[model samples]
Target: MRVVHLLRKYNPAEWGGTETAIQRLFEGLRQHRVTSVTYAPSIGSSIAADPLTEAGFAVKRFRACVPVWGISTERKRQLIAVGGNLMSFDLIARLLREPNVALMHTHTLGRLGGIALTSARLRRIPSVVTIHGGFLDLPESMTNNFRNAHRGGLEWGKLFGALLRSRRLLKDADAVVTCNRKEAALLKEKQTCKRIVVQPHGVPTSLYRKDHRESAREAFPSIRDQRLLLAVGRIDPVKNQRWLVEQASGIFRRHPDAMLGLAGACTDEAYGESLKRKIDELGLRQRVFLTGGLPPGDPRLIGLFQSAEVIVLPSVSETFGLVILEAWAAGTTVISSRTSGALDLIQHGENGLLFDLGAPETLHQAVDCALLHPELKSRLAATGGRVASAEYDVTVLAGRMKYLYDQLIAEKNALRNSAG
Candidate 1:
């Protein structure tokens, strides 16, 4: 079956959880004989090779805009980069004219998702929408940041959003999928009739099987003798890299050998600037290393994961902590904030440790727990690795998805036959 996967933003240079999840899913789907095509907004000036295209999947890019007026060029660009409610007539036209699409699966919501859903309805094909980020279950602070993104701009896309029924996307979709159970529960409350699938993001265990520790050490000699506490995510306020930096001094007091490594591209330049200032102010220049945007499955990236004593996620919000699974696959312990994703994946003291975002001290304590006990760290990593291999493998999850696709297609065909 040919399925068109829709994305609002896709930049390999600025890769994050959503990009990694889609890439892994595509790899899994290939084994099921599913023909996958990706549709995304063009990344204007990025010369970065489309990783999906390089992997032999058809990736089509269409022009999209922020759909707002009276906003500065910089402001408009920021909105687009950080989950702007983009509108694209070109995307709508492209989907309408495309042939033999069995399904339309959207990885984003808002105008773009609406376009996919509307087009699927027009073609009488099943449309699926996946919530990559927390919507109904977002924290108040994170909600505020989204609202403030375009606060002063004149949003001219409300009309287009209404025309495409963007607000009703969840209700209108053939299936709604989220990685976090809490997000699914909250979505069910709002749209009781929707088909809500709670699928945790998957990882490829093979790539991380080889020991890349020596390669990682050679690449960055400074971390050779230190116990690395790594945080892998975008350098954004939501990822809460700044918060991790703030806690570094205290973490160092207890474990002086511990080094902080923040890996990922900087999506928010302003937030990125602030993070650098905070690091300098705290006198953590020698202790912290900022490795800008590493591609998924990169030997160095996997090596860093394997080298880390603890994988730290201080995110204010995470729909599904994909990093936690990656760390697990690399056979490393994880300490994360009590986001919806972390709470769902981690069993507290069993596989990984979870701390509250409200209580900063709790995060420090969780780190202390993992760092102080070598046996506990090894136990946690071993259990987590087993879980990743048995439960969250990409190929296994792809089989589950193929079943869903086949079921939906069969039901649709049956309805058509009866109508005829």
Candidate 2:
């Protein structure tokens, strides 16, 4: 089966959860004789000159806009930093002309998604969109943060591309896929007759076989002598790295030799700067280490996961916390905010742990619980490893997706024949 993925922006140099999830999915897809061609906008000159081979898939990047051309500095930052969600009409035209496209799968939600849906209708093919980020269940403060973070004049790209066409995408999509049940239900409320599919992101299960603790500790000298408490995600306000820093001091008070590591790229420069300032103000310069973003399959990332005592996810909104499963696959204990994603994957004291996202103090309390109890960590690690290997492996996830694709294609052919 052949499929095309329409994405808003994909820069491997500045990778995030969405990029990682798709990359892992492609691994299983290739094995199942499914080839995926990805089309996205070239945001800045940041994307590689040859995005196809560089991105490990059939990638074709269409130009969205000129860099630093006809825009203010703040607008440029918003466009470059968080991405302006500009649609490439050229890319859409090219998408409609592609040959032998059995189905279209979109991972974006704006004008780009609308283009995919429109083309699918014109071609008599089925198209589905996956909501990577959770929006329906987001709290008021987080919803405001998303809106205010990129608010500015002179962002015409945003006006014409993402904002204006968002509702149309929702109304016209053939099917809506979500990474978690809550988001699926939310889409159902929006379009009750529309098909809603729930497919959780997955991880490689092989990483759990061995801890690699000794080598991992040796590689990172900073954490060699200290107990490691790690948080993996982009440095953004939504990811809640600042709250993790605020809770770090309390953890330090208990385990004085413990060190906190923040791994992932700095997607939001303003938010990234604020995190550094907060860390210094709280006198956690030595206790907290911020490693800039690392690429997928990086050995250091594998090491960080294998060696860290506990992996924490303190997101303001997470649809399906893929990192939680990655931690479990690495044979590490897990803790996350009580988002729908976390609640779906973790059982309070069973495979993983969950804390309230609203109460900042609860993070400290959860950290305290794990620090003193070695057995809790070990039990979670072992049980989590079993669950991740059995259910969340990428290969297993690929089978489910292939079945869905077959069903969609069969239904589309039947309808076409009936109309004829």
Q: How far is each candidate from the true structure, as Cα RMSD in Å?
A: 1.2, 2.8
Per-residue lDDT of model 2, residues 78-178, tens digit only:
55455345555576678888888989998887667777877788888988888887657677886676565444444455555443355567666667778
12, model 1: CA deviation in Å? 1.0
- The TM-score that candidate 2 achieves is 0.92
- Per-residue lDDT for 59-170 in model 1, tens only? 8999999988888998888888887899998888899898999999999999999999999988988888888987889989778878887787789999999999999998
Error of 2 at 388 (Å): 0.9
What is the C-alpha local distance difference test score of candidate 1? 0.90
**Residue 213 miss distance in model 2 (angstroms):** 3.7
Q: After superposition, how far is residue 97 of candidate 2 from its true place, in Å?
A: 2.3
Model 2 error, position 256 (Å): 0.8
TM-score of each: 0.98, 0.92
